[model samples]
Target: MRPLKSLVAASVLLSGCNGMPVAFTQDPVYDQAFVVHSGGPLPYMLMGTAVQWNEEYAVTVKHIPYVPGSVYQGQGDIQFFRHKANGVPLWRGYTPGEAVTAVGYNSLYMSVKGSGHALPAMVRLDAKEGNVLYGTHDGPVAKGMSGGPVFAADGKVVGITVAFLSSSELAALKRPDLASQSRVSIFLPYAEINREWGRYLAQAQPVTAAPTHLASR
Candidate 1:
């Protein structure tokens, strides 16, 4: 195993939000997220959630199998376009430390993983249900959720799911024992993720109708 990389590692603890941790799913933050499929034999095998950033490209963890890279190295051999969008993207922003919701797309990868930690395939965040932001939560983020998005208090975008924290990584942080804290999903801050892809979003344009030309026959 290459080891998880986003769970409970390097986070910014926020305040004011409850910290009791809710169930696997009940919130609608997953509404803002869509299932992304990788073009492969098992289209659903390499699936995760993609968050809509604007009008052009949706965002997800680049490490997800949907992201183009070497699978042997855990870089996700497939891409994020095999599946189609199911709904509209989010249209709001998020605040730090506010209890939000999350949902994971049910994928074959999860089935193969033996339901690691007994967590559901979906994600959810709530204000009074231990849905803290900036760092910390007590839910459940399974293996296939690598590219999912973390929601804010009002169903807005906050962070993009990264990966689970490995034992060595947890030990380095001196926070060994990630038993009940399996839902402490780690995500890349929205601003940083934006900065990395803002230019692409700004420049990406949709195809429009072509204009007629006098020389055309």
Candidate 2:
């Protein structure tokens, strides 16, 4: 895996403030999976990765960012792209002020801090015109949320939840004396997975026998 620094450089180049807003006419191409630790079922979603796995089990590790204080109000959604194949869900669920890390393309990862819950939320917009694709409401980010998927209404993997900011960071951003800080969450582009799906599947070992045709997609 590439180091976080190297990954950030590439991500920055690929990251954009705009998204496409055309209504989705078809269901996502991949199936959604979860890596829950001990909860009934989370507001789970699906995501995809290019890295092949030794086993079919979901990738449960996560990287969170570092932030200072209570600037986030926890009221929005984080936007990201979905890989067409080998789609894996990136999990996001943290307190208003927490620190976490996330893995990215080129095997790079980064640490991020959350200011408030709202800061971690994403708003999918039109890639061409920058219009809203869809939005998710804010809710409590629980433990073991890492490695879970953030899904769209059509059940497509949009983005993964990385982490939240620390209390000090939030306070600093909210301070009247300081300029506003832009809140961010790290995510893997879904399209990237689509490009690398074969590579990942080749490396993945089935955890269980493939489900029956009716049971399986």
On lDDT, the leading prediction is: 1
lDDT of 2 at 121: 38
lDDT of each: 0.42, 0.29
Candidate 2 residue-wise lDDT at 78: 24
Question: Which candidate comes out best when scored by TM-score?
Answer: 1
Model 2 bad stretches (over 4 Å) = 1-33, 36-57, 62-140, 167-186, 192-217
* Every model: Cα RMSD to truth: 12.0, 17.7
**What is candidate 2's TM-score against the reference?**
0.28
16-123 in candidate 1: lDDT tens per residue?
111222224334445555566554544544556666655535566544443432222112211122233455455443444456555454443221111111122222
Candidate 2 per-residue C-alpha lDDT over 11-75 given as tens digits, one digit per residue, 9 for 90 to 100: 33333311111222222332243222211232223221222121333332222211111111111
